[model samples]
Target: MRQGSNFLWFLRAAVGAAILLGAVLLTACGSVEDVDLTPACPTGVGRGIWDPGSLEGKDAGPEVRKLLESPRFGATPQAVRDLERGIVDQRLIAALRTLTQEHRICVRAFKEGHYFLPGVEDGPRIPEGYGKAGGLPNTHYYGRAADVWWVDGKPVEGNATDQDVMEIGEILAGIPSGRRPDQIIGPPRWARDLGYGNQRGWILAPDQLELHRDHIHIGYVNGEATNETR
Candidate 1:
């Protein structure tokens, strides 16, 4: 009888162990169904018409020019050059303006030597298989993506946990669904330990997380545009 009881106990213990392991695995591999994928704020505040001349502060009018020239919403020289060449999405500029003006968050868009190039340079190297969507080149190539390494005058490297950095990520993530950035990867804390797009939240895989430790990468759908100019 004792032998039978021991066998039963062993079986129960094995089952319990298996259950525990499964739970651990489930938690480690977070389920998309379980998490709230809905955008935190879907107001579409930053949506703006695509004006290639906006980068030069011309076609979009004086307000956009003022915003682009503002110290609070500055960019690196290379980024400025890219902007002058009309290489960034208009929505991104609007988002930057919103971040700076509405939230009082100073943002330096794109690290120097990095703006719209594909291969990689300073800051975080674009992870392999990233940047491309639907058999097309990466969003950066199409000017729909940017990497901001400075916020509130602080470098993103050591300030990943800073309030400004976290807020920036949160705001970017909260952009309206559909027009929202499909890729919003930043420091671990603000990104909810994952990301916020691709039907699974930004950082699709663990491998992509490390690549975004030093900068906030924001990429939108390639062809999206708005009719309203700033």
Candidate 2:
């Protein structure tokens, strides 16, 4: 009886020690849920006050034109065609240009579809039972969103575990509030790692995560800037 009790105790101790060691390893390796990578805003560039006037314009402004012509940024053929025909907000153009130039990252923009028109066939048709009911229409419809599927010659899909992709997502998330997009969606693991687990606009829900796994969606409010920062 004494020998049997000693054996049982040893077995329990071994199991407990193994479980503790596994937890330690997970923490040391910086598991997604356990890691927090809230990045610091650049010097003198903390979240700036939004200038409502910045988004008020009927046509693509000079800055928007310049950014579209910039070599730092690239776009899909469909995106180029749609962008030329559609009017994109200037603030979004500025943000994308800055993202590409500063990071030396190749940003390939893609269009979602035509903006929602009253009677156009190919124009904004939200599938029934899709997304949060009563949610706002797709930002792309307002030319306030851009989808990036490729970065620096690498496809964003199937590369969620890549450090480079995570770093880029982090940079986008870290942009000062009012300057960054209102909705930034990327890989599920990296999104959580960047402290966007419970963020209002950042992707966290399972449905959103699945839809955005292939691309990074940067969306802005039509006339106002979002108020979220690292």
Candidate 3:
């Protein structure tokens, strides 16, 4: 009986040690994935780390208010006020800044514009396929989207050309794919790879929607309208 008790004690000690070692090894192997954008706002009001399952409110935090106020967004003060009515993602704000910087030379050289220019009558409206599964694919209601008004050297609405469309498409497509399904909505391949949306693609076609031709729609592709509204 003494020998059996000693053996049991030793086995228990071995198991405890093994568990501790496994935990230490797992902690040592912890990964640090790169995030493309650091959210300017806190984890609330539609401005948290990108999550497709989550919906956010339209309330802008201090950081978001600062972004809206910046001239770099290319929106007049009034236009910014209008956009603030809908909820926008923190990632989209970061993406817009990145997009503007990426196209600065083109904008300067060819007079391209972004967001809302001074005289533009309209701003971003909800895309036609806001709730469609394979369409815009979980964007719009939460303000994770925008419409760019200029491409190359002309206005997107009535003046953009096929070449302009291709150029902007490549740029928009090149934005790094999101870590989750709801983080992005674009090419069907991209959506499929993330394990969401149908295979038909998310970019609206000219025939499918007329106004889309003038301006390219950009979004962080997070969450459905029904889920978001509720």
Candidate 4:
């Protein structure tokens, strides 16, 4: 009878262990599923939280934290460092990565005063203050935009020639429009060629020859407007 009791106790312990193991496995699987796990941008780099309101250094939520850690945005050493301190949209980072990698070029984070809320007296206004049609600042205020220059084969933040920067813009212009009415703004031809006559909104073409001569601007645009400049 004692032998029989020992066997029963062993069986009970074994069953308990199996149940605990199953619970652990189930918890892990559930965790993987419950997380958004969506590619940060469209390129399968990182997980992006769509909240544009969370600026860098301001919002460190789990979703945004995951995006900041993505390797796709870590093109140049400077870019990787910038990702730590600044907050730009995941799409913008992904697009910039594509441009630099495709052409073997290098670009860094926008100069300190360029992004929305540069935290300086003379910094440029966010797009919301641009005073133009469809200029509600969805892109700049949300940190979904960048002004990148071509530093051919140099480290991020390296100086770029005018021709090299223009070339970078041309390639960036060809990227398809995004879920929002995104644009690549630089030389007129680049914008006109890619943005002509599509259901999507027009990519802006600079009228002045000297506009954006130093860099290319690409990112989201204001909401749809009938009078939006193409």
Candidate 5:
């Protein structure tokens, strides 16, 4: 009788262990199913957040943190497969990762004073009061988009080139042939007057050009350029 009881206990213990293992596997699978992963990225020599898979920086939240740590977003998933195939452009993929992180109407990398082009001059330094779009005192607007050049820990000679910066203007122009939209803030008339429509057309409110002469101020609902949803 004692021998029989020992056999039964052993069977129960084995079954319990199996159940625990099954629970762990199920939990892991569930977690994997709940993350958004990007694909394998080309290793750019530059230090930008081009690799969305490594998005576990101080800026990420729980959802982003979980996604970065999971297999679906990490490897062996459609997003990863797309990246490996070059089905998605690395720059565009990086941009999308940035755009989706917040409900930001516009995403820009702004510097100080002027719109961040490759070069600058020593005029009266723009004070703290200066901002993009209509960023005026006592009357600031949200989603009036703009970008400034920013490079951390690198000494700038005040004569940077397009190659050094991510010229989004050039990227937007190439979108049309690829079956994407012409652009949100299209090429300037200055560019078109020079006649280069062999590429896709650009998109920006013609009337507001004067107001945005200094910055590429993108507004969401000014009855002009309100395409913040994309």
Candidate 6:
């Protein structure tokens, strides 16, 4: 509640405008203040714990302002925010965040009351066989699937040598495989794996994840993968 004072003030401002003569108006024009730059990622390239503005000096947009104004979507939702992208389809983002929260995953960006690691993940790279299933099984082209080395932004260094990825993967298995489809290639061998990454070989490195070697591919909001048939 006290962490973000700027939004707190706007919360009481009432939509930045007033309504009159059947016309709605805000108190002032909408503008985004410049956000702070970090050494790890100067351009705000990586994902943040919460929204971009929550960082040291990022501009809080109208969406953030509206969220602040609404007392209902406070504290709870903010506590689990991890991926904060400036996308027009906010509903989809909100849905993903909600799903994460429902699974008890503590997201950095969604959560307002907590302090989180500044950088979650650097950016997902495009894996091979995008938009089309590769020569391997369970591999397909759809914006919905991705071979992420990291989840929610943080990399899970594994599959080759980084034991961290395994630890993270174990935790990530918390979400339903059908929904997350995070790795979608090679998950853990012994443990309960996700639905998409149920293929053979390559147990834990983002590199050996078939279609993904150096960089993983993240699909768009409405992407679909052709598994089993491929």
CA lDDT of each prediction against the hidden true structure = 0.57, 0.59, 0.41, 0.46, 0.33, 0.32
Q: What is the model-wide C-alpha lDDT for candidate 3? A: 0.41
Model 2: per-residue lDDT, tens digit, 1-230?
Answer: 99999999999999999999988889787676544322122223222232324434535456655555554456644555445554566667777776765443333343444322334423233433444422445666667778776665466788876776777776676667677776777767657666763344575666667667777777775457565544
lDDT per residue for candidate 1 within 8-59, as digits (tens), equals 9999999999999988977986764553322211223111223345454335
Worst 10-residue lDDT window for candidate 6 reads 34-43
lDDT of model 2, residue 79: 57
Error of 2 at 52 (Å): 29
How high is each candidate's TM-score?
0.57, 0.60, 0.41, 0.43, 0.25, 0.30
Candidate of highest TM-score: 2
Query: Which whole-number lDDT from 0 to 100 does residue 119 have in model 1?
Result: 64
Sliding window of 10 residues with minimal summed lDDT for model 2:
38-47
Better of 1 and 3 by TM-score: 1
Worst 10 residues of 5 by lDDT: 137-146
Q: Between 4 and 6, whose TM-score is larger?
A: 4
Candidate 4 residue-wise lDDT at 163: 49
Candidate 2: segments with Cα more than 4 A from true spot = 1-59, 103-125, 129-135, 197-201, 227-230
- Runs in model 4 deviating more than 4 A are 1-82, 106-111, 115-135, 151-170, 173-181, 189-202, 205-210, 222-230
Name model 5 segments beyond 4 Å from true: 1-54, 57-171, 176-181, 186-189, 193-201, 216-230
